[model samples]
Target chain A: MLEKKTHLNLLYDFYHSLLTDKQRQYMELYYYDDLSLGEIAEEFQVSRQAVYEHLKRAEELLHKYESQLQLVAKYEQRQQLLKRMGAILEESSPDLEELKRLVSALKNVD
Target chain B: MLEKKTHLNLLYDFYHSLLTDKQRQYMELYYYDDLSLGEIAEEFQVSRQAVYEHLKRAEELLHKYESQLQLVAKYEQRQQLLKRMGAILEESSPDLEELKRLVSALKNVD
Candidate 1:
């Protein structure tokens, strides 16, 4: 459950702007704001089923965007690149070949 | 006109997979394949107006994606980082402060 929440939270970070207002609202409340479905439904003066459906649809859209864009995946790659560079810098003499390789690979990242 | 085309073409590269088959078709034919609207319309057995609408909607979505996600903007920044790193590598001894600053900034890129 925690893993799923973490993944969804990351996806939300990358693709929330693509969502509609209600979709965005539900996600924020359920995930970030830590509100339960019942609480959200009561606040919005809607049925629990309606809130669930909204959250479900919003979750599905977040997954869809992540699958298509892979922004999160690319983001991880970028982070890995930075960490690798930091490791290289730690060496007595920076690894010239490795840094060159990283630089070349970095060029194609975008 | 050429600048718009160039910008759209780059946008298309990053977001093409998000487009529908018809939108992808229209964009490729009109941009990369360099087909006129009339030519694409004739080939697809659709009206020029239909083709134009598809291209316009696709282009709008591309712009929307860019504005929200900024993948293209991020991609350009990544490229710039590589160029800057390349310049550093060309030096007899890379400026350590500059390289460290780059590594730190790169962590926030995604």
Candidate 2:
């Protein structure tokens, strides 16, 4: 459950702009602000079931976006490559060839 | 019109996966393959008007994706930065601090 939350949070960061304003609002309140579903429903003047359905649909869209776009996956890949390159750059005598390969890989990411 | 085509082509490359198979096919046929709308319509046994609308909607969605995500913008930015950094790395004594700053900026790219 925690793993799913973490994944959803990362996905939400990437694709939240594609969601409806109300969906974004509910997601922020429920995930970031740690509001209970009941709290979100009450604040939004909707039934808890309605709020749950909205969140579920919003989440499904986020997953769809990820499956299609892979933006977050590409992002994580680039970050990993950058960290390795940074470590190499900090060496006294950086392996220029290896750095070049890393840069090439970075360019080809996604 | 040519500029818009070029821009849309690039956007399509980035976001085509988000579009439906039919949308992708129409886009590729119209843009990449340079098939006339009437030709595409005939190929698919649809009216030319329907083909035009599908292409229009697909193009609009591509633009919307670009506006929301800016994946192409970030990709271009990183490419430029990498080119500049690559040039420096080729020099006998690369500016380590400047390279570090570039790396840092890359890490922060959306």
Candidate 3:
């Protein structure tokens, strides 16, 4: 469940804009706000089943986007590289200016 | 015209998966494959005006995706950073191991 949430959050970061307004609202509540189906349904004045369906469809859409574009995968790869650079910098007392440049380069990747 | 084509190509690269199948077909032919409207229209069995409209709608959708997500901008920035790193490596005789690591890191970002 935690792994699913983390994965969904990353997918949301990459593709939420492609979702419909209602799908976006449900996902925002369910994933980010930690709302249950019943809660989201109540907030949206819809049935619990309706909320579940919307969330399921939204998840499918996010999955489809990731499968074709791989933006999230690319993002994670860049992040891993940045983290590696950070570790390298920690070990070496690289020059202050050079360190700043390296950090800025890392920042630009995101 | 060249600038518009370049911008559309970048936007298409980032958000083509979010497009409808028909939109994707139109964009693939018009932008990437460099098909004329009349040729696409004949191939798709649609009028030239219809092809134009589809392309226009696809362009708008691509623009909307870019405004909300900025993935293309992020990609271009990472490319710029990678290019800068390449330039630095070229000028300096950085350690072979370190240069290989940096190059691998740069390759991972893309």
Candidate 4:
């Protein structure tokens, strides 16, 4: 079971890395643009099943990448750090020096 | 310039994929957990420079992945899709049938 999970993760990562422009566009339209599958299918002049397949593949790719590299996990961590830094900055605490030091450390991250 | 950018991208991706547990931990503590470099250095019983170097390497890794595979970009796209789907669901539009189809499509992604 662990091995299967690991395999799925690797596959997700590779698929995520390999998405083409069209796949990305379709994803944006269907998910973000709030288009229905039928709407998307009509826009692309493809069958609903074809649109479904593309989305499924894209999701799989994202999962694969997450399992293998944990990119999303890391990104979320960074975002949390940014939020903490923002809070610290707002508080005007005596620990401002420490915050600055923390900021400098983060500067080295990206 | 493009070549340089591409090189950076590749390096970032490779580094991101290769982060060790120690490196990831350091990243989480310093960036997400809001630890100061001095604090992190003390915790790890290492020099500040060593900590900085680890962070620098990790940031390089993330940027490398962004450049090569655009994982972050894709994740953002997915998040947007989810949000849109949520919005559509909230509206209870006549397109709900399409929304159902879209949901089915997204299910295929994972």
Candidate 5:
């Protein structure tokens, strides 16, 4: 499982780096758009396997990127920090500097 | 700013779709791992501008994925829901069915 995750991370990184415009469109349709593989194939005038390949490759690419860079991990960390900050803000005694620092850190991500 | 953001989004998606293995490595060093641009350039034996360009392009690609599929948006929604659920769990009267449903929904994201 660890090996698989590492492989997936490598694939993810590669996918992030080297995607074509059309491939990206297809990926968005399948993953983010929540379209079925068959639907994506039809939209792209391709076979189901081709669509599957695209998605599989895309997943691989994302994983590749993640392994090398751990972007997802960092993003998750930042998110957790944001949540903690939110919780802190809800408290009666909020730390102003801490809030500012957290906000600045988040802004740096963009 | 909005136009810049849109452009960044497109770039981000494109980056996500098509990153090279080496590029992914550089990106992780720069973004998630928080390596400075200069440090990444030195490690890769690339110029500072090259590193900058790589980082810029990578950022663009991430934004593109976000805009096209709104994965970040969906993730945020899930996080918010989780927070709410956490809050609910802390409440005196917790809803068991709602908790189960929410957990099920989150599990589906993976």
Candidate 6:
């Protein structure tokens, strides 16, 4: 199983824009900002269960979008390829700092 | 104003997965498959106006998603950078076919 934080982070990266303002806010608080459900509920003046349910629905929507699009998967593959290419470049010229910088630029592209 | 075909193509690329089956079908037929609205309406047993409305809504949703995310913008930027890098690589070593291939691979990502 994917780690919860890792999965939520990738999903938020890919589909946060598609989510409603409330969903995005909750996700940002719960996942990226590291707030607990009770804390989020108190912040929003909602029940803890309501906050949990909202997060669950947001996750399901993100999963549905990802299943259809595979953008996150493609991003991960590109990142892996860039890392491998960086390794090759390092082997060819350990002192080529410019090449390393270029590789880093390409890898961080998203 | 952006050309209608070009705008639709980028919108489709970025948000097609978020559309309904009917909306996706209408868009694919009109933008990608080059079918006229009337022809698409006939194929789907809907009126031309209905088909046009569906395509319009799909375009609007795509634009909304894009406005929030800017995925298409980022993709175009990456392509431009890749082309620039390719030019530099070509100037450095015109006979480096492997490097050219790698540049092509990076450019066609997505």
Clashes of each: 0, 0, 0, 15, 40, 0
- Residue B92, candidate 3: how far off, in angstroms? 3.6
Looking only at chain B, model 4 earns a TM-score of 0.64
Report lDDT (CA) for all predictions: 0.87, 0.90, 0.77, 0.61, 0.60, 0.74
State the lDDT of candidate 5 residue by residue for A44-78, as single tens digits. 78999988887677676666555644556655556
TM-score, prediction 2: 0.95
Which digits, one per residue and each the tens of the lDDT, describe model 5 over residues B2-110? 7765544444433443566666777767645779988888887889999888777766667655554455565456566666656655566555456556545543442
Tell me, what's the RMSD of every candidate? 1.5, 1.6, 6.1, 18.1, 11.8, 6.2
Per-residue lDDT of model 3, residues B1-110, tens digit only: 59978988888877887789999998898888889999999998989999999889999999988898887876776676656554654554534355446546555544
Candidates sorted by TM-score, best first: 1, 2, 6, 3, 4, 5
Deviation (Å) of A41 in candidate 4: 1.8
Off by over 4 Å in 6: A92-110, B92-110
> Residue-wise lDDT of candidate 2 within B12-104, one digit each (tens)?
989999899999999999888899999999999999999999999998999999999998898899998888888888889878788878888
Better of 2 and 6 by lDDT: 2
For residues A1-110, could you state the per-residue lDDT of candidate 6 as single tens digits?
A: 35977976887887787888999899889877889999999999999999999999999998988897777886777666555554554464433345445545664554
**For candidate 4, lDDT tens digit of each residue in A48-86?**
999999888887667756677665555555456555545
List of chain B TM-scores, one per candidate: 0.94, 0.93, 0.75, 0.64, 0.62, 0.74
Report per-candidate DockQ: 0.77, 0.72, 0.22, 0.05, 0.05, 0.23
Give TM per candidate.
0.95, 0.95, 0.74, 0.43, 0.40, 0.75
lDDT of 6 by residue, B1-110 (tens): 35867866877877788889999988888777789998998898989999999988998999987897777876776666555554554464433345445545664554
Candidate 3 per-residue lDDT over residues A35-71, each given as its tens digit: 9999988888989999999999999999998898887
Greater-lDDT candidate between 1 and 5: 1
Instruction: Return whichever of 2 and 5 wins on TM-score.
Output: 2
Off by over 4 Å in 2: none
lDDT of 3 at A20: 97
Q: Which candidate, 1 or 6, would have the higher lDDT against the true structure?
A: 1
Per-residue lDDT tens digits for candidate 1, residues B1-110, read 59878888889989998999989988888888889999999999999999999988999999998998888888888778778988898788888668878888777777
Query: Residue A45's C-alpha lDDT in candidate 1?
Result: 100
Which model, 1 or 2, shows the larger lDDT? Answer: 2
Worst 10 residues of 5 chain A by lDDT: A8-17
Number of the predicted model whose DockQ against the real structure is largest? 1
